[model samples]
Target: MTRTLYLFGSAAPPVFDVARVIEDAQSGGWDVCLGLTPTAADWLGEGLDGLAALTGHPVRSSYKRPGDPDVWPAADAVLVAPATFNTINAWALGLTDRFIVGVVAEGIGKGIPLAVMPCVNAAYVQHRAFERSVRELREMGVTVLYGEGGFVPNLPGQGRKEAYPWDLALTAMDDLVPKREA
Candidate 1:
């Protein structure tokens, strides 16, 4: 049985390369469903359709209306890559204002295996909320690859977009819920 992976992205530089990441997830034997933060959707702009086509699922950035059928299949695992400072804090606090945050927050209660890799700078890391958020998420059984062997903070205004650990996040997701052979 093919496993479905919900890959959610925030408005970090790595989000620009989400199409390639989706392909990578697919190659790893997952049916990829893409979801993005509002800013990420806007940033993706014209490429949204292309990403949708690539994943064979709509790139959702908003919640469907009440009673509307879910477009994507049930997720066997969730990977939140390039999570921004705001995204991490909001998720840790259970603030579901954003579509991606909402699903991930609920995914926890539903017991869906989840992993997140935060893409933040050194300045953002100094914020007290950031550390608390990471701790909270980890306490909730969420695999947070924030430091060492995961995503280390770069200096502000000096982000190495190319260096974001998309592979590491994908690997963590695979570890959370590996695909089962038919």
Candidate 2:
């Protein structure tokens, strides 16, 4: 059976390229559903409709009211690409003030496999909370693609949008699923 992948995004600039990420996830045999942080949703602006079409689901940015039925299918995997510094810190603390964070917090509690690729600058990564968050999330069984082999930090004011390690996050998700021997 094909697995459902929830592609979550933050306000980082790279979240604009989420269509490409959706394509990648789809090519990997996953049915993609997207949820963006509020800021990221605003950033999408006119492009939001296109993304919704690509995923065949509404691009959700807020939580539905209580007593509302589930809008999307259960997620088999979750990828938070362009995960911002604030989002990282908030998610690490299990804060769920927004839709994306709520999904992340719930996903973790439900033991859903999660892979995150944070898009903060080099200086941002030096913040105590950033490192601590990465460690904390990892301990929670979230696959944080960071350090040498995963996401290499870029200098502040010199963001490398073209070079973000989207592949590694996908690979991490692939690693989460056990492969059947051919």
Candidate number of the best lDDT? 1
lDDT of 1 by residue, 27-89 (tens): 999999999999999999999989999999999999999999999999999999889999999
Alpha-carbon runs more than 4 Å astray in model 1: none
Off by over 4 Å in 2: 178-182
lDDT string for model 2 (62-98, tens) is 9998999877898888998889899999999989998
* Cα displacement (Å) at residue 81, model 1: 1.0
Q: Write down the lDDT of every candidate, Cα atoms only.
A: 0.93, 0.87
TM for candidate 1 is 0.98
Task: Please state every model's RMSD to the true fold in angstroms.
Answer: 0.7, 1.7
